[model samples]
Target: MAALLLIATAALLAFRGAYADKVYPAVAVGDVPVGGLPRDAAETRLAERAAALAAQPLRFAAGDRTWTPTLADLGVSLDLEASLGAAYRVGREATAPDRLWSAANLVRNDRAVPFGLRLDLGVLGRWCDGIDAEFGREPRAAALVVEGATVSIEPEVDGIAVDREAVRAAAVAAVAAPSDGVAPLPIVTTPAAIRAADLAGARARVGAALAAPVAVVHEGRRWELAPEDLGRFVAPIVDPARTGADAVTLDLDQPALAAFLSERFAAEIEREPVDALLGWNEGPVVVEEGVDGRAIQAETFAREVTTAFFAPGGTVPVPVEIVKPAVDGTNLDQLGITTLLARGDSNYDGGSFDRDTNVEVGARLLNGTLVPPGGEFSFNGAIGEITADKGYVVSTVVQGERAGRDIGGGICQVSTTVFRAALLAGLPITEWWPHSYRILTYEHDGWGPGYDASILQPEGDPFGGGDLRFANPSDSWLLVESWTTGVHVVVNIYGPDLGYDAQFSETTFDGPFPHEEADLETVNPALPPGTIEQTEWPLDGSEASFTRDVYGPDGELLESRQFFTKFRGRGNVWQVSPDMVGQSPAGG
Candidate 1:
């Protein structure tokens, strides 16, 4: 008995030693057995099973069409190392008896080791793409067509879809079992949201309405919308009051109706104010009379048409408001247009070709302009943008004692003449600006020192103001006449003779400042040392002022305005000899 017990003990020890660090007997990976397998051997067996599973194919059917895809192409994979590790641990325990008992149970039944699984849905989706086109259809809903006063209902169709996820799930289960059979792609169906029965009442409401025509008439002009066009305007709808018993009826689309009226009548009824056309054939003549403006009253006309549209005749007369011209041909004589009311004249040295061009161009712009009663005139605006393209030229413009050349330099001559004309006409001088330096040309023609006016585009002027402007205080239109003869240019304002008088007091020059000299030396190598050359003459500086007074038609002083100005002496300019290098300027 002792010998037999030792042999049994040896056999058990051999068995444990042989199977060390390996899966015990009766252990299974899926349906395949891996009993007593080492880590490498178990992994090899699992890999073989994976290969065989990858070789299997699945039959996928959507209606009459069928597609087969291998399990490997569907992203099926197995972790052989993990499966082997689970099998190896089946009989592993801390105590010998517990390990022995676990080994006995493994030998008794084939234990399946649970494992994780993975699939690439992207690959599956690509295979299933477009499969639905053969087995799916979209549902169509009911619709209605509207004639002038009629509506009709259209039918609905059901929808069907080939289920995509269900097919993939079934494929997964088949691939996992390593077997192949026919699998169906589940199909789903649904009814459309709106059916033909829903529009029964709405259709009857539109079909039962009567056809009618409407007429739009204006000033002997008439346009009619017939029944055919009226048909396009009708539509059926759900019961608005929610009574659920009333049939939907045809109604006029008010927006569409209003659009039609605007299209046919808006342009025909709008007119702009026209001024009387004056002509001169030896004397002023009204060649073409001005017409009064007119505007269509859209709201009133629309209301009338809409009200009459439902009535018998359907005739509507257009409504418009008359707008009268401010100064019509009938009042040309009262505006003093037949006679001269005022005149302003000045002279310019036409010796400079470019300077004369600017002067003449600026004067022509002011000619023939008509200023209505209570209207203001802008000298700068009349000349527009002062560019070289406007026929002006680069010439001398003086700021204090500084002088520079500009394209529209001579425009100031025209502005100064206009300013004097405004003063003599007894009109309200709303705005005026004086030059930075007194221009001798302005004083040459019996005008005072403070009479010169200068101008530039708003951006170029430092004072941010216009050079000259005036308001026509007369109750009629005023016409400006301008012309140039030799070096003299004149501006005359013609309007109803207000019989008012204007006068300017003598210019007072009281304050005087002695002239100062400044040396503007230019190097002259040809001259001897200490030698000086005077290039410019200097003048004394002074302040001068004048007053303008205007009387009313009754000879009463209506308003008084004063003009004040100052002149700075142009400091003397001198050129020094280059030979005077070592000499003191004071010594000279």
Candidate 2:
């Protein structure tokens, strides 16, 4: 009996020693037996199982639809080392007798070591979210529709929403035991917040607002907006403050209302302020009284109209802003334009019809010009642009050394007349330019050629033009008045006289340098063949100079200035047919 006991103890010792570094018999990891195997071997077996489970596809179902995704796609991974460690420690972690008893009992009852599975809840949740998106439906609220003058309502719709949490929980359970690989999507029905019955009050309000035509009144004039127009100006909007039947309200569209007002009433409500026209008749006189302008206040009108629109229709006054004129009747008397200072005249008789028309138009433009004390007056600024739109006609003008036809040809006659007036008035001349050649009209009435002033406005170059400018040196404002008789044009300056005598010396002439040739010709494609038109006659060049001396009321000399002019000789310029270009005329 003693010899048999020793042999059994040795066998038991060998069994305990073998399993001390390995898993006990009948122990398994997630239904895969790993007992009686070394730690490394157990790890390898569990790793292979993990890989197989990871590649296995799990099914997710919603109604008739199904999606198959692998465990790896759901971020599921098994901890092989932890599973091996848990299986190895199961029967060996207690007292010596208790450990021996547990290890022997494992042979009779098989033990399954729960898998050490790591599931990324975030990944599982997202996968379920994708399924939810495919199955979920959002509810639609009731809406109001408007067409022309009719109003209607659109009904609300109920929806279905998927329960994402239930899907995620099922996915986790399926991953733990990959044999159970199906997850079902859970869903609930939802109702819409706003029903068709809740919009009845709002619909009635909108209908009433569009039932009548509204009027906008200003200064005894009425502008009407019909029922169809009102429908376009008002819309139905949701208001959170009201409950049940008043969940929505009818409101006016501010931008639309303002646009309608501008399109209909802008011309009648807006006007430019008219400045008082000043003229010298005996003393100073107001040719026309100034009138204040009116402008519509768009924002103010919109606010007022909105209030009237909500009140279900009434007449609203149009808001207007008053604009005052620059020179009104109240300030005219303070200008102190009390006497006639000087007058200048020129003759336009025997001139072409276009020239005569231009002279008349130029005189009319400078009729009521008023220059403030010490203000610089520009001829180009006073007459504005010399365009056909301003009544100027095409006439003869000097271009380079020849004559041509262009707009504003006789405008220089007006400038020269005003120049002679400014010279007689003893005003300071800031800018003055002489003509390139002598003109017979400027030398009329015994006035010499050196006394003329010329102005040019080059096309497309506003700043490159020449202007005649002068400064008023008096203590009071100067009023320039002009008019044209059938034969002549006259310009007069009126202001408080400075009591000065302006004296000018006789113009001295030198050298009648004759022109080098008799005939200069150019091609004109527009002229008929064999036609010859003389644009300019030959003239001899000459130099002229004069002196101006201004004496004050006390006979003291105030200013002394000398003026000089040089004119280049020019031959007769002829515009002939293209065949005769570059050839002398018949007699030349």
- For each candidate, the alpha-carbon lDDT, in order, equals 0.68, 0.78
Query: Whole-model lDDT for model 2 versus the true structure?
Result: 0.78
Candidate 2 pairs with clashing backbones = none
Off by over 4 Å in 2: 1-33, 36-108, 113-139, 157-162, 177-191, 239-246, 271-295, 323-588
* Candidate 2: tens digits of C-alpha lDDT, residues 1-588: 999989967876888887777888889987789988988899889989989877877776777888787777676767777788789888886698777677768868988888887778787667656765777778776767767777778898877765655555554566555554456646666766677899887778777766776788988888776767767766556655654556666667777778777777888888888667787667777898889998788878877876776675579899989989866778877787888888988876667788778878988998888887888888888888888888988987733335677887778888888999999988778999988787767777889878888888898874368888989887678888998976777899888868989999988989788867656777778888777788677888988989999899999999999989998898777888877665547332
Badly placed stretches (over 4 Å) of model 1 are 1-338, 398-401, 459-465, 515-540, 572-588
Candidate 1, residues 1-588, lDDT tens digits: the string is 999989967877777788887777778877768887777888888888877777678776765777777766666556677767777887787788887787667657777786435677886666555555655778765556655544567776778775656766765676447456677656677676556776676555444433455676778888776655655655344453542224343345666665666666668777877666554444455656778898776666655655654453658777788878765667766665655656787778633677777889888766766787788887776667777776777875532234345776677888888887888887887777777555677776677788776666755663355557788886677777676788887987777768778888989976458766453445556668777765444666778888889898889998898888877766555556877643434333
- Give the distance in Å from residue 190's predicted Cα in candidate 2 to where it truly belongs: 5.8
Best by TM-score: 2
Clash totals in order:
4, 0
